[model samples]
Target: MLYFDHSASTPIHPAVLKLMQDTELNHFGNPSSAHQFGQKSRLVIEIARKQMAQAIGCLSSEIIFTGGGTEANNLVLWNLLHQQKKHVITSAIEHPSVLNVLKQLKEFGVTFTIIPVDHACRVNPEDIQNAITKNTGLISIMFANNEVGTVQPIERIGKIAEQHGIPFHSDAVQILGKIPINISDQKITMVSFSAHKFYGPKGVGVLYLKKGTNPKSLVIGGGQERNLRAGTENTSCIAGLGLASELANKNIAKRKTHLEQLADQFKLEMTDAYPEIIYNGHPEHSLPGVISATFPAVTSNILIIKLDLQGIAVSSGSACSSGSVNTSHVLRAMNMSNDHNIRTLRISFGRDNSKEDVHLLTEKISEILKQHHNKR
Candidate 1:
């Protein structure tokens, strides 16, 4: 199948896959054990952590391993409960991980302000500034939206958070490999990443907590991840993540250019075929490979199945809420109509995609639209 869902998860790179397999087969000892095998496993995890830190320009000691992006996001947001000020400032277009955690925090008497985004799904930095209160202890914003692929003004937001002495956290799951990240330059206090989103193995993620920012430990067991996160590490997956980080750091520019070419080719062909087609997300400040296209008369659910039968893999929105009947909260927050929301399809390109893949996708979409019109 032609996979166009890179935002959900990327296919593991061959090199990363090989490393993971080798590590899993040869180094199966628990990292907590004091034996030679355990020490080797420990080394593997540290190397991965260091690679991730280097990729984002942070200290190796600042990284914490977690189950995935959700856990990573939770680790930061949930820690607000232990703070003297329990209020957070975030955008309305955050992933379910952030939104859901914030929602649940409400029950614990921790209030939050969800600043609204504009029609382009871009959060206004001024709105976030206005929403911040004296009690606002944290500002959690996503680096790039998962559904619409709109890159937020995180650097500005980080500055605002800094001015107010609030910790800034970004759900950077979609931005890691696609964008060049400099944690210190951005002034972000914390950022989260899932290895699978960057062509590494699944079930592994990283939370980059800036030095001098201490959130309460989310998991308390043995002394792992500097007592911030506990439990045995997934050594093989961590190795894969390290390799993926190294690859990303080396090829960020190359990958960005390629994906932009693909996205440009796609839009040119798609707009030529359907002039009324609507593209969501910021046209200027957006992820290169991700596209959110809305077809006015088409039902995305039906189109998704039809495309699937033709071996074209796409998604209606976030993979987590794929089959749900409810429309996307991201689109809704941007004031997208219910009709347009239902008609929207998220087509995300990855390193594996090519010009040929774009041609096939647009051709199939045209063919399907023609069939639907003819039937009607």
Candidate 2:
């Protein structure tokens, strides 16, 4: 099958798989134990931490491993809200992991302001700044949007948050392996990551917290993960994540160029064949491999099923909310018309996809659209 759903989850890299298998076979001890086996496991976890820190340009102590991106995002929001019931500013197009957590904070007297995006789903840094108030304690914007692939002006927003003394947090899960990340230079205080999004094993994620910033622990038990997250560490997955991060750091340029070429080819082909196609997201300031296209008069759900039947896997929206009847919140936030929003589909490329794969996908999509038009 031609998989065009890398934004949801990527296939694990062979090297990352090997690292996990090797770690699982040799390091089976609890990291909390003082035995030699346990010490070995602890060392493996620390090495992985260091590797991740190096990749993201942060200190090893600043990186906290969590279950996944959702937990990482939750931990940050929970900590900020628990500290004070102040207002938080976030873009309307954030992943549900961030938006849903913010929604739950209303019960705790924590108010939030959602800054809207433009037609291309790009959040304006000025809008974020204008939304900030004296009561605003945190600004949580995504580094890059998942569904539409619009890259936010995170550095600009981060600077604004710094000037206001508000902690800036970004959901960087989608951008981690797709672009070069230098968190230190971005003025961002915290960022969330999921290993599975970057060709690593699932169930492992990272929350990068700047030094001198301590968020309250969400999990409290054994003194694991510097007492921030409690429980025995998943040694194998952590090691795999480390290897994946290293590989991503090393091969980002090459992979990015490849994906961009394929994405461009696919769009050109689709637009050439179907003049009515409406492209979503910022055309110039988006991720390399991701595209959201709206096919007029076509239901995204029906198109997705038809594409799947043709051995082409794609998504109608964010995977987390794929099958939901609700319209895409991202598209709605962009002020997109109800018709275009309902007809949108998200196609994300990955390292494994080729130009030929794009050709096949576009050809199949053309055929499907033709069939739909004939029926009409």
Candidate 3:
């Protein structure tokens, strides 16, 4: 199958898979144990921590490994809520992990200010600044949107948060491998990552907390992850995440150029073939390899199925909310028309995809639309 769902998850790189398998087979000791085997495992985890930290330009001590991106986001939101921060600030287009957690926090008398995005699904830093109040203790915004691939003005938002003395957090899961991210330069207080988004094994993620930023632990019972995250580390997955991060950091420039070419080619070909196609996200400031488009007179669900039948994989929305009956919250927040929302499809590329792959995708999609029209 020609996979075009990199935003949902990426196939593990061969090197990363090999490292994970080797570690799992030979290193089975609990990281908390004091025995030689445990120490070896612990060392591996720390090394991985350093690797992740280096990738994002943060201190090794600042990296807290979590089960996945959802948990990392939960940890940050939960901690802020626990601190009795009565007000929080976030964008309307955050991942469900952040938006849903904020929804649950309303039970504790926490008020939220959701800044809406523009028609291109780009957040306004000025709006974020104006939303801050004395009770607003934290601001959570995504670095780049998952579905539409719109990159936020994170540096400007970070500066606003700094001026207001509120902690700033970004869900950087999609940005980690596709673009270069240095937490130091962005002035972001905390960031979340998922390994599977960047060709690493699933089940491992990282939360980068800058120095002097403290969040209460979400899990209890163990002293792992500096007591910020509990339970013995998933050693193999952590190792894989480290190797993946290193590879991503080393080759980001090349990968960005390649993916950009493929995404542009796909858009040019598809739009030329189908004039009714409407592109989503910011025209110039979007992610390199991800694109969303609306196909007129077609429901995305049916179109996705047709594409899948033709051996091309794409997504109607976020993988986390695939089966849900509701429309995309991201699209809804962007003020997309109901008809266009139903017709939206998110197509993401990766290192494995090439110009030829994009050509095939465009051809198949054109055929599918024609078939769909003929039947209608």
Candidate 4:
């Protein structure tokens, strides 16, 4: 089957899988132990930490491994609240992991302002600045939206937060391996990333907390991750993640330019078939791998099933909550019509995809829309 859902999750890279297998076979020991076996595992985990930190241009001391991006995000938000209780500013288009945690933080005497997105599914930095009162403590925005593929001007927003003295964090899972990142440039106090999003082993993630930022730890146990995360390191997964990060750092530019060409080809073909197709998200600032679009009059779920029957795999939106009846919160924030929400499809390319794959998908999508036009 043709997999066009890379944004949801990627196939584990062969190199990463090989490293993980090696770790499990040869370094299967509790990293907390001081014995030779455990010592070997601990050293491997430390090297992985340095690799992840280097990928983001941060110090090794700033990297904290977590179960995944969700936990990393929660750790940042919870700790920032611990530092001080105040209002938070987050975009309406954030992943549910951040929004859900923000929802829970309401009970902790912390209020929040959910900034709305424009037609391109981008949050206005001005709106964020306007939403901040004297009491705003933090501002959290995703670096790249998962469903819509909009890349926010995070560094711009970060500058705003800097002037206001508010801690700023970004959920960088979607953008980690796809874009060039300099966490220092954004003045980002905390950044969350998942290895699975970048073709690495799953259940491994990193949280970058800037030096001297001092976000408190939520999980308390034996000293690990320099007391930020208090659990035994997953040496195998960490090794896999380091390999993936290194590969991504080396291959980002070529992958980005190639994927953009593929995405453009797909969009152009599909648009020729359905002239009324509406492209969601910012055209220029979007990730090269993702193309979100809506076909007139036809619900995406129905069209997707038709494509799947023809051996194509795509998604209606975020994999986390796709099968549900609700519209995407990102689309809703843009105040798009119900048809825009219902007809939306997110087809994301990956390292394995090619222009030929796009051509086949385009032909299949054309057939589906043509059949619908005839029915009407």
Candidate 5:
């Protein structure tokens, strides 16, 4: 089956998988133990930490491993609970993990302003600046949107936050492997990433906290993850993530060029079949592999099923919100018409996809549309 849903999750790299298996077989000891076995596991965790840190260009001590991006996001936002009567600035297009946590923080007297995005699904840095108030303590925005793949002006926003002395956080889950990242260069205070998004095993994530930025720990019992995250480290998964980060960092430019070419080919091929197709998100500033479009007269749900039956895999929107009767919050924020919203499709390419896959996808789509028109 052709998998075009890389935004949802990626197939683990074969090398990463093999390393995970080997790590599990060779080093299956508690990292907290003082014995040699545990020391070996501890060394494994530290090495992985250094690998992840080097990939993102951050200090090794600043890297904290979490269960996933969701947890890493929660860990960052949860710090707001300690401050009363605080306000936060975030974009309307953030992942639910960040938005939902801010919602819960409301009960504890933390208010947040959601800056709306433009039609291209991009957050204006000026809007974030305007939303900032004396009570503003943090600003959280995704580096790139998951559904529409719009890359926000995070560096500009980070500069604004730095000027205002507000802590800035970015959910970099979607952009981690697809883009070159230097956490040290950006004024960002914290960043969240999931390994699975970058051809690594699931259940492994990283949080990059800038030096001197300490968020409250969500898990507190034993002294694990430098007293930030407490649990037996997932050594095998961490090893896999370390290798994945290294590979992605090494080949980012090459992978990005490949994915962008595929995306361009898909759009060019689909243009003739559906002249009325509305390409969503920014034309130039968006992620290379993610293509969000609205095909006129075609409901996304039906189109998804048709594509799946034809051995093609795509998504209506974010995997988390799929199957819900509700439409995408990102589309709504961009002021998309309800009709257009229902017709939207998000196709994300990955390292394994190719020009042939793009051609076949367009052919299948053309066939589906022709059959659909004939039926009508």
Candidate 6:
């Protein structure tokens, strides 16, 4: 497949895969165990954790490894509103993992105010500030949108939360490697990340909780991940994540330029070919690798299938909702429907993609557009 779905998940790099294999063979001891094997495993895990922290410019202890972004997001939401009748502020465009947890948690008197986005699929921090109440306990906004690729003003929102003495969290799974992240400067106390979002193995995620910023534990078992996340650690995956982070630190600059150039080329070509295509997300403030656009009278899912049949993979919505053709909740919540809703497709560029791939995909898309128009 052409694989234009890096935002959904990136393919594992050779270095990362090799590291994971080596770790599986050598670091088989449990992190909790105190024997020589256990010490060796713990040492490796700690070194990996340090590398991950350095990748994001944070301290090693601040990084809490979880199953993936979904679990990391769950860890924050569930712990904050566990037994309280507290108020939460979120955006309408959060991933299903974030939205579903918040939706289900509302059953126990946990109140929420979701800030709506504009047609560009961006939430205004002012709206969040307006929604804050005396009972407000948490503000959970994503750093970058999963579907539309809109990067939010996390610093501004973080400031708002700080002024009100409420804890702020962000699901940074989509933008972790694409952008420079320093949780210290933002009002964010909790941030979620995933290894698969970069060129690392799946099933390993990171949660950065600032020092002295402790939330209630989500998993209850052995004291792994400093009691924030409990369970025997996936040593291999953790090792893979460390290796990926190290590689990302070294290669992010080059990858950023390549992905951004590809996206710009895509916008120029696709827009010239189909002027009726509607852009989604912040035109300038979105992630460099994600491009969400809608072509009139054409459903994004149809294009996805045609592209897939031609070995060009894409997504209509978030990967969490694998087979649903439902309108993107991010757009629907913005009060648009019909063509605007159904025609949107997410084109995610990656480090491995090239200008030739973009050209070829656009060519295929043009053919599909012509066929679609002729049928109409």
Give each model's whole-structure lDDT.
Answer: 0.90, 0.90, 0.90, 0.88, 0.90, 0.86
In model 6, where is the ten-residue run with the lowest total lDDT?
A: 78-87
List, in order, the clash count of every candidate structure: 0, 0, 0, 0, 0, 0
Task: Give the alpha carbon lDDT tens digit for every residue of 1-376 in model 5.
Answer: 9999999999999999999999999889999999999999889889889999999999999999999999999998888877753798888999999998889988988898999999999988988888988888889999999999999898898899899888899999998778888888899999999999999999989999888876777987888887898878999999999998998887789989999999989999999778888899998888989999998677988889999998899999988775689989999999998999999999999999989989999998888778877888
lDDT of 4 by residue, 194-240 (tens): 99999898898998888887766788888888787888888999999
Query: lDDT score, residue 75, model 4?
Result: 88
Better of 3 and 6 by lDDT: 3
Q: What's the alpha carbon RMSD for model 5?
A: 1.0
Q: Is candidate 1 or candidate 4 better by TM-score?
A: 1
lDDT of 3 at 331: 96
Cα lDDT tens digits, model 2, 233-292, are: 999999999888888888789988998999889889998888889888898888999989
**Residue 363 in candidate 5, Cα distance off native in Å:** 0.8
Angstrom error of the Cα, residue 125, model 5: value is 1.0
- In model 5, what are the clashing residue pairs, if there are any? none
Candidate 2 vs 6: which has more TM-score: 2
Per-residue lDDT tens digits for candidate 3, residues 1-376, read: 8999999999999999999899998888998999999998988898999999999998999999999899999999888666756789998998999898888988988789999999999998999888888889889999999999999998899899988888998999998778898787887898999999989989899999888877788878888888898788899999999999988888789999999999889989998989879999999889998989999778999888888887889998799986799999999999997888999999999998978899988998888889888988
How far residue 212's Cα lies from its native spot in candidate 4, in Å, is: 1.5
Give the per-residue lDDT of model 6 (tens digit) for 1-376. Answer: 6999898899998999998899999889988898999999999899889989988878898989999999988988887566453888999989898889878987867878989988777888889989988888889999988888888888899889999988888999988668777666677888888999888999999989988987878778877888887788999999899988888767677778888899889889989988888777788888887988888788887898899999999888788888776778887976777668788898999888999999998999999999999998
Off by over 4 Å in 6: 82-85
Residue 300, model 3: lDDT of 92
What are the RMSD figures for all models against the true structure?
Answer: 1.0, 1.1, 1.0, 1.3, 1.0, 1.4
Full-model lDDT, candidate 4: 0.88
- 2 or 4, greater by TM-score: 2
Clashing pairs in 2: none
TM-score (all chains, Cα) for each model: 0.98, 0.98, 0.98, 0.97, 0.98, 0.96
